[model samples]
Target chain A: MSPEKVQGGLEPSETVAIVGASLAGGACITRLRELGFTGRIQAIDCDPFAPYDRPPLSKRFLAQNTEIETPRWWSPDCEVIRARAVAFDAQRRALRLRDTSGAERNISADAVVIATGAQPRRLPIEPDGVFALRTAGDALALRHAVDAGAKHVAVIGAGVLGTEIASSLRQQDLQVSMVDAASLPLVRLLGRGMGARAIDWMKEWNVDLHLGVRIESIRCDHGVCAVTLGSGVAIESDLIISAVGARPAVDWLINSGLAIRDGVLCDASGSALSMGHNVVPRVYVAGDVASVECPNGSFARDESWTGAKQQGVKVAETMYYGAQQTVQPEPPYFWTEQFGRRVQILGRVSENGAVSCVKSVPDRNGGLFKVAESGAHVAWIAINAPSLFAQVKAGLLP
Target chain B: MKVALDAKRCQGHARCAAFAPETFVFDDEGFSRVREGFENVKPELQEKVRRACTNCPEGAITISG
Candidate 1:
């Protein structure tokens, strides 16, 4: 909380620069304006398009044949610059940016928000007709491929995104086979019982689940990909979608002296943490690019849309209030739509936790609750039962 | 202040309940709702209610007098 540790507070006339211009950056800028901050704001992004939500990329946006509209949140007075930040000068609080034309520029600001987000993790052998969805363009390209008669799809990784894509494709009458190295998809997040339930749902949706197998090689010929599993079984498909998760887009922060681990390491208050445990002044991080360490000593990189937006507001507050204002940390929240059902999860559920069905009916399939070994309610998962989820969430609150 | 919730957009994050437990309550399925008789947040808890609305990631909560 020292001013020298995390830099001085913001002044009314000082300029604040934000990188990424994705959900987190958009939230930060919009919240700042909502709070009536008159300081100069510079929002930067490499993409030509304005800020947009990414959740629909795999669901509605990909399934529909309509135009994708970018969500507008910035004020008329705010400056939106289309450029990629190449480097950061911590001492001077300036960033070196490269425009689309390859022209370079330097912008100095009193505070900087790194919301660069993340990019999809690719496999070692990327053959033709392989796709990964992270941005709007990626989704559009995959949709176009599907529309172009790509019949059978082999989705690698059965996590949230992969399962979601598989489910969506099934709804569109496209044959989908989902492969995952884990014994059960989402086991790490939902634990054994709940994760097994997800498997049952996927089977019910007719998605071929190839679990506990490693992909040996991917060979593509004439717009068709033949994926050979470790068991010497080959699965052929018209296209392959790799939803193997994402890593923080932190290439620009390298060599800038910031402690780069899985993502930009930050304290709970959203200030960037250096290698020696000191806060890097004026540098705040949010969204997928930020791995925040809580007081409990564990670090979490919440890649959900909700986490990104919440962190964005917190980081903006830290920039304006100089870390003096204690941020009330919210529970981790995430939701996914697939198999014509909405799966909503709130709070953290450990792998060994005991899960029980809090509510069960023909309409509501997944109202399961997990409690820690200490009998503390840890997490709740609901399928199309948002109100039930909310009830469980409220009871867990202090 | 009058507190409103865009129930459809709420993903049952429960952040609103955490910030203002007295003003907000959870529906049977876990989405947020104004307490049984607290549709208009009490004057003493209005600030906390506002914080709850502000922290909602879905932007589902709103407050206006």
Candidate 2:
């Protein structure tokens, strides 16, 4: 690659400011350098610690928080600001931040990257005992609750995150009950046939799964937490996990005025869309904050760990390195582990219709599964049969 | 003919694509995609491909007419 893009002699060419030094932002910075973005590369985070992993936070870390205190950090040379990006000025190509010390700093950049990951969405009732798992602090807090003899843990939401959290709670020897609004667990991701199989696996683990139901509120009853479902049913528990889903962390970008859609609206190249009227220069976005529209006319707002990492790296390469490669929205891919069953899906599932399992072979607590033609297979989901998913992944002709 | 996944109408059913991997791919959020060789999915594979589309729960995948 070309020599790292440099700005000045003593000072670099142009300062690069990355908001949210977590997964996407950090990946971009490192990749920018790899793609020869040698100018002063900077990354900012509100947390005192540097950037780390997320999958583990929900899986291994939750089970053994005592062993892994926080997600691992980056190399010593990579720049990190233990601060929060508070605002973006697309006009001036600058960013406003409040560091860990409570001091605000204004940093200007030739370009900006918004990778302000997501936060655990909470319910309004102020559930006295329920919590959501997203950040390191959240994981640590949940660990404390589990160790403190919290019995009858009720995890709300039956998606991957909620399932793993409940399974971990059960591993801690706490009775776990999983609640979701879907007819079967993972109905949205794995389809009905595979979903039933997943429920069967959870059953083996003895999880009290309340499928097709949602918990309306979490309140304490006689010193223990009572989770109330919409059906006027209360499930007694010492812990409750609220994991519906995560929204874009765009509170800071409210007035940034760069065309915010479900996530940040981005071009095929991951460049931020502009209404620049000459006052603002072009800005680009990737990761969770970016929703990329492929040249093929398809679009995706990907938020998985793999999606963010690869997209971040690609954005850096295309913009800085002269690859000039346009990003295509690939099919969705994510995996979840619950009660010894590894469920992975390669494609989308429609909400408006039916799901018929194409082929079935007995495998895990469930078996290998492929979610049929939802809308995209380049993005498909597979569980315990990546070998079969591999056939589809290669675009292999039948 | 172009390929498209009508995401709004999708439900995860792996029918149209599974039998004919050469013709379709059912991925993320119940979205189906037209495979490469867009020019030619062998006549033998057409039945499997069409069957997948017919069995699709949401009828989301539609190849250009």
Candidate with the greatest TM-score versus the true structure: 1
Per-residue lDDT of model 1, residues A291-333, tens digit only: 9997798788988876887888888777776764565566777
**Model 2, residue A397: what's the lDDT?**
25
Error of 1 at A241 (Å): 0.3
Whole-model lDDT per candidate? 0.80, 0.64
Rate residue A372 of model 2 by lDDT: 43
How large is the C-alpha RMSD of every model relative to the true structure?
3.9, 12.0
Model 1 stretches astray by more than 4 angstroms: A1-7, A65-67, A70-77, A396-398, B1-65
The TM-scores, chain A only, for the candidates as listed are: 0.93, 0.85
Q: Cα deviation in Å at residue A6, candidate 1? A: 12
Best by lDDT: 1
